[model samples]
Structure formats: structure tokens, C-alpha cells
Target: MTNPPEKTPENPWGPQNSSPEQPFGQQPVQGQPAADPYGQPQYGQPQQPAADPYGQPQYGQPQQPAADPYGQPQYGQPAAQDPNAMANPYAQQGNGQPGYGQMAYGPTPALTSWIKRVGSHLIDWAPITIINRITDPMIGGYDYASKTERVGTNPTLGFILLVVGFAWFIWNMVFKDGKTGVSLGRQVLGIQLVNADTGQPVGAGKAFLRQIAHILDTISCLIGYLFPLWDSRRQTFADKICNTLVIDTK
Candidate 1:
């Protein structure tokens, strides 16, 4: 009999087949990952986080604030004003005049006294009053007149004077005063009629409207004309309605 083959132990799992390239005793199963001995990441897997070499902020670290995108003023800096902003109508002025709004020219003039205003009005109406007195006999007289005395002796002359007076009032009060900010009476009294807000003349149309507004004074028992005595702005109802002022030009 040939020398008996040396006795050898058989692998319990499978037949032993080892190679120099595969240091382990057997090859890994197909489609299964190989075990790593040094805990290194395998191919196709995500990498672990590493230290920042450039000293930049990393995830979960504090960061510096960014610059303002709008270039707004920083802390302790004065804020800039908007050029298109509207002016305040009620703003007080340094010279003690209450502001009506923005005026392109300058500060408003001082207000005239009630006495001066009244005197100026009287001066303006003097011519009409005298003409009315002179023409009284040409128009219908009072009911108390004797029957022998005829009323309205010359209606033509009375009508003529009436037209003249009305024309005179319109020319002086509306046209002249509106254009120049003064009538003959206002000029003599050192007063002026002007827009309260602008310190400028009110045009002829507005002056005519102001005369119509005076009807309020008449209907209110003439108390509107006297409003200047107690009113803070020294304005009559007509003046208030027209946004006008009687100011001292002197």
C-alpha cells in the first residue's frame, strides 16, 4: 500500500482556498461590502467633516455682520431728510408767526389792529356814502314825507350816480386792491390785504369772491366784521373764508 496520505482537518464553513492577493482565508461574498480593518471610509461613501485650514467661519460657528445693502446711516449718525416731503402746515416759526404752510417768498407780515381795519373800511366807503346823500332827493323819499313834496325828482341823475359808485367800488376794492395788495384806503392807513398763507396779493377773482362772502357778516348782524376783536387771527368771516389777512405794511 502506498504511504498513507497525511491526515488534514477540513474547514467547517467551506473548503479552504486562499491566495497571496487575498490575505484573508476566504474571498467575500459577491455584492457584499468588504470589512475595513482601519475604520477608513469606503469608496462611494460621503466624507467626514475636516478642520478649516484658512481660518474662515465654519458651520455652527459665530459670523460677522454684513454691510447694509441700502447704505443707510449707521449708529450715532444723523438721519438724512427726504427732499420730496411735504411741509407741516401748523409748524411754528422762529419769528412767532404760526405757519399756514410753506411760503416761497418770506415770513408773513404782522397783523393789523381791529381799529385800523375798521378805519380803513370807513375810508373806502366814504365816497359812496357821500354820493348816496347827494342823490337822496332824486330817489323815492321816506313814507313820512309831505304829499306836496314830490319824491324822486331826477331819477336819471340818481341812476347815473348809482352806476358810478358801483363801478368805483369794484375798481378800487377788487381790481386795485387785489393786484397791489392795497386799496386807496389801505394805502392811506398803512395796511394791506394779502393771502394769509403766502404773504402775497390775492388776485381779482378772489377779491370779488371775498366781497360776496361779506354777505355772511351782514346776515350775522355784523358780528362777523367784529370777529377780529376776539378772534386769534384777527380775521373776519370774509377774511377767514377767503384765506386773507389785513396786515400792517408800515
Candidate 2:
């Protein structure tokens, strides 16, 4: 057999070492630089001049801290509060209704008319006048011009008339008015009397006081009865003094 080529100092592994077991090309010599398999500098090729120690992306250059893209709370920081939330406990509810202790707006109640009040007054007094007319014969039957004139002449009959009248007055004005804040005439007229401040029936005592106060309204040139035409509460002088209001129930 022919002798294999001898190894030399320049080619230490012999000429057989020239062809390497590489995939695409021949292998490098021992002290010679090899080609880059990817056509670029190989690992031992001068190391790219030490990478320009202070070049392009230099160390200690200010790098902005990564921004929080989702506004999430930082590790050691408290989250901010929403400013639009309600602060009051009694504010309107989520369903739009008023909360506790809040008053809702409503239509105001209607006041009684002056004409109806006059009609009620006439109806209330008709029975008293009729009673006096019927009892006139018992009290000497004198044809007097007015009730006061007739009562002035017959003292015994006057006393009897007074008691009966007082009883009727209490039944109509005090008991009935107190119980329902309505007399027969007021009931007919679809109106009611109420304590001005409370919007409720006046009691017996208040009803009595209210009746007694009527004399003042009568003596005021009958102007008191006409007051309800323009009055805000539809009150006469008696109603004002009695702290009462006349409202239309219908």
C-alpha cells in the first residue's frame, strides 16, 4: 500500500485534516481562521473590536421606567378614589325615588269658595229661624221686626228659646263640626273644616270657640264672610281667629 501523506508544522493533522466532516464545506487549518458557516465572522474572529465600550445603547443612559398600561395600582401605592360617588346617606336612591325623611312634591289642596261658604251658613241658620217662628205663638206671638226685639220683650219665653237654641247650636256646630269638621250644609256643599296647622278635625272645644268667634265676623260689616272670595286659605274672620281652614273635599 502507498504511504499516507506525512504531517507538517503548517498542517499539523496532515492533509487529511484539510477536509473536515462539516456539512457544507472543508475544515480550517490549525492556526488559520475558519470561514463562518453563515457567511459572517466566526466565534474567534477578533471579537468585533470590543463592541465600542461606550457606543449606541450606552450604560447609565436614562431609560424611562416601563409605563403602567392598565392603570393598575403600583406595588407600594394606594389606589385613587372615584370623585363622582354620592357622599350623602339620604340622597336619592338608585331607582330614582326619594330616600328617608325626604318629602315628595304633590299638588296643593283646593280651598272652599265664598259662594259655597255663604250657602252653608244660610243652611245652618235656617233651622234656628224656623224654630223661632214656630215658637212665636207660645211667647205671646207678637209680630216683632227682628229676633232680638222679640226676645227682649218675653223674658220667660226668651229663656226657654235660649236654652233650646244653645242645645241646637251645640248639636250642629260643636259635636257635628268637631267629629267630622263638617256641618250639614258643609257636607252638602262638599267642603270640610280642619285645624289650619294640623289638617284635621277641630275638637269640641275648638268648634265651640269657632262658633263663638262667628259673632266677630258678623259684626265686621259682614266683610268677614266676603273675605274667602280673595283669601288664600278661604278663611273668614272666624276661621282666622279659630285657626281653621275650609277646604273643598270634592
Best by lDDT: 1
Candidate 1 overall lDDT versus native: 0.85
lDDT of each residue in 63-83, candidate 1, tens digit only: 744556786766777767768
For candidate 2, write residues 120-166 as lDDT tens digits: 88888888887776556556544456544333456577568867876
Q: What is the C-alpha RMSD of each candidate to the true structure, in Å?
A: 11.2, 13.5
State in Å the error of residue 36, model 2.
Answer: 69
- Which regions in candidate 1 have their CA more than 4 angstroms from the true location? 1-107, 141-150
- Candidate no. 2 TM-score: 0.51
- In candidate 2 the C-alpha lDDT for residue 206 amounts to 91
lDDT (0 to 1) per candidate: 0.85, 0.77
Q: Candidate 2: minimum summed lDDT over ten consecutive residues — where?
A: 49-58
Q: How much is the lDDT of residue 110 in candidate 1?
A: 85
Task: Give the best candidate by TM-score.
Answer: 1
